[model samples]
Target: MELLKKNIHMNRQKSQAVMQVTLEEDFNVPDSKADVGSIIQDEAGVKIEDMKVANGQVMVTGAMEVEVLYVADNKERKVHRLTERLPFEEQINMEGAETGDNVQLKWDIEDLSVSLINSRKLSTRALLTFSAAVEEIYDVSAAVEIHGDGEISSLSKNLDMLQLTVQKKDILRIKDEITLASNKPNIQEVLWKSIQLRGTDIRILDGQLDVKGEFFIFVLYAGDDENGTMQWVETALPFAGTVDCSGCSPSMVDDVELSVASVSLEPRPDYDGEERILALEIVLDLDIKLYEEDKVEILEDVYSPAKELKPVTMQQVYESLVMKNFAKCRSSERVRMENNQPRMLQICHSRGDVKIDDTQVVENGLKVEGAVFADILYITSDDTLPFALMHGVVPFSHVIEVPGIDGTCRYSLKTQLEQLSTTMIDSEELEVKVGINLNALVVRVHKEDCIVDMEEAQLDMKKLAELPGIVGYIVQPGDSLWSIAKQYYTTPDRICRLNNLESEDVQAGNKLIIMKTVEITD
Candidate 1:
């Protein structure tokens, strides 16, 4: 007789690779632009054009857009904007990769530097990091129940499997006509504009996802004033979007990411010159990942009462995205000088970069250590009105107390600068503070054992007649009713009824009477 067995199927697939590269480029100023004097603001955006896999390697082709706002060296102190697009192609080693695999890539600028080469040329350098994750879907038909004349013993555990329900990409466009305040100047030349996604609120209902978020728009514009002075203004834009995810349930987990692909800005046509109005257009890329959890009982081991059975067992480990945590870390650093310290006049621009140094998984959560680098440009306390640059580094450490995390889990951490500011503490000192956000996604791999197949073994039929129908047995350590009944060729229900036991749990050193039944095969 064949033993009846059950099996469980895993629900998730995940793999990741990370690599870093330094990018450098030399760009000439536009034909009509003046030479660069001091760089004010620098921004970069990355777009993946194509990706493919062959011979255990992943080929990635993408472009990085770099925009710099700088002051000209002319007598007028003109402000100019220069933009360039640089393409890159690289191969990353990914074991077991093949064609048509689903791959997602994320690009990050870790550090950047802009140097003035001449009045009409500039050099740009940046340290970039690319991370890619590939997930493959598998459909496994698990056996739920066994059908045969044999006894089946199994071990099982509950798993919150991550089942991919929906994967889709869409474009979200934001159009708005914003009017400047009465005290501000009219838009002459738009120097630079940056968009930051501050927060997101999501709701899932009836296979649909509703998304709402806040976008902060910072614009630096040169006024129509006689001196052509430049100033910066900020505004908030509220946006809403929807995603269709059919066959998805409300109990499932959702992971959504939004990125700015491109942006366009123009002065409104009906500008009255009193309250300056500008038209803003922004394109956003959206991605949705949904996961559904399932529980299944797997048959681990089996045996037969009338024969000796050899069961084939197999074990495998699977990985899944467990949870993502969003947190903010704030730190401040002070730069001091004893003498000849440049006094602060006004800060032109300020930005920061944060790097994750280490992550230690403890009993409850993770202890994260990192450092923040701040760059500030200011019209300093010096002659000839030269722009002075100051840099500061601050070290930070934070404890993320998330419960239920163990040694078997791994995590990925990403940090971004939210805001940076500087305050002059005295004529010889300045305080720099930065606010950064950390997004940590945890992934877990679990192991399970399953009984694949079984074989029948020979048994002694003459010994069955000499065995007693009822016997007294003493419970030993780690003894259970199922184990005792399976050994005596009886069921747990019959053993409980015969002994008049209140429950299936029995203590050690207890005496119980067992009734046995022997099965005969044809």
Candidate 2:
């Protein structure tokens, strides 16, 4: 007997590791910039430069970009900006990782603080966390059929499975231009800017993918007027594009994650030769995985009545998608200013980020506990310090509905800040509204014992001769026609024909006759 096998392709995560690092550094003010008096606000971002994988370990090299806005100590008390890059390297221990493995790295800035050490020096510190995962793609060989000259009795089953069809990484670059309004002044120099993406949507189509989103851009710049006063502009820009995804169909399920890898804004001159046009270049990185459902016919068990047959079996693991859902959490809170801090004159801009603290599987759902860290930039009542920053945290606990979820299910969650807005309730208190979006994909893992190959040997003629040619038997519990025939060295068809049975079904305590068949080989 020969075993016919088929290979099923699959993609899974091999191993994952997370590392946290605290970075602290001291930087001196540039000779051209004014001396810093006090810091107002700070922004930070992490960029991965290179990743190297070795035996059982991975090394990640990256840099943190920090921008600080502070008031100068001069008589004018002007707001000045300072920027720096801090390089970092971390080695993570990951078992079963090897060279040329596909590794994905995700980073977050937990906290960033900047303090004024002296009139010319500043101290900066940041807490960062990095998560690394290695993905492996392989094939599982399973027995589907058998081909041989002997009469083989086989049992087959149909299994529902998910097959990985596409696994790749691609980039989409969005280019657009923003022109200053006719009423706004010409740009002299950009001081502080914040860019964030919100309400992003990704759709899978035939041979392509569609992406649509809007990014909020806020820029505080020094105007080219006679007084050189500082001016700010905030606007939301809409972006839409498509990616060419070969072999992708609408029926397939997609698990795609997108992030803004890098962005830049350049000041350009308009038709009148004034710096009115701002050129924007944003790069989006996408990690794509597509799965299609399939039904496979597999050999479950095999036996032979005329010859000795033994099947070799092994265990294989498979994955099935349970659910893919998107959930949203809305929260509103009031932030009160401290007695020592300056009161808010008017709200300018607001930004927030969502951090997941814990996630656990509950009854038919996933419980998510997290907080939103928000920063509000506003004009201050104090004439000496015209601008101020307020920081607040809004804690949230929500349960995402996922039917049939259990401890054995594997899930991945991605969170994003869909909307953030701030309004002044009073001079000392402000109201904050936040909208968070959570995307989750849950899968079930199962193991199955499958027959791979079989070994054959010659039957013993002496033992066969000692056995009786006919016998009477009574059906016992957990008895089947195939099992009874195999136990007596006879075919199920022969037993059914002798008993005049309509089907292979048998009951306990039923009387049956068994006969042995001998095969002669030359």
Task: List clashing residue pairs in candidate 1.
Answer: 35-119
What lDDT does candidate 1 reach at residue 436? 75
Quote each prediction's TM-score: 0.85, 0.91
In candidate 1 the C-alpha lDDT for residue 85 amounts to 82
In candidate 1, position 276 carries an lDDT of 77
RMSD over all Cα atoms, model 1: 3.8
User: Which regions of candidate 1 fall more than 4 Å away from where they truly are?
Assistant: 1-14, 150-160, 271-275, 319-328, 335-343, 377-389, 412-422, 426-429, 433-443, 460-471, 488-490, 519-522
**Decoy 2 TM-score against native:** 0.91
| Model 1 per-residue lDDT tens digits across residues 1-522 | 444444334534456788888889998998888878877567788878888887678898888889887767777666688988888998888776778766667778867777888878888888889877766666543334455665544434455555566666667777887788778778788887767665566677787777787776767788888866666777778888766768767787666666778788886545344437878887877766666666555554454554666666566665566676878878888976435446667765555667778899987777889887765656666543444556678888887766767898866665666666788776556788877777776767777555566666676565655556799999999998878877776666677888898898898998889876675444
lDDT of 2 by residue, 236-264 (tens): 99999999999999888887888888888
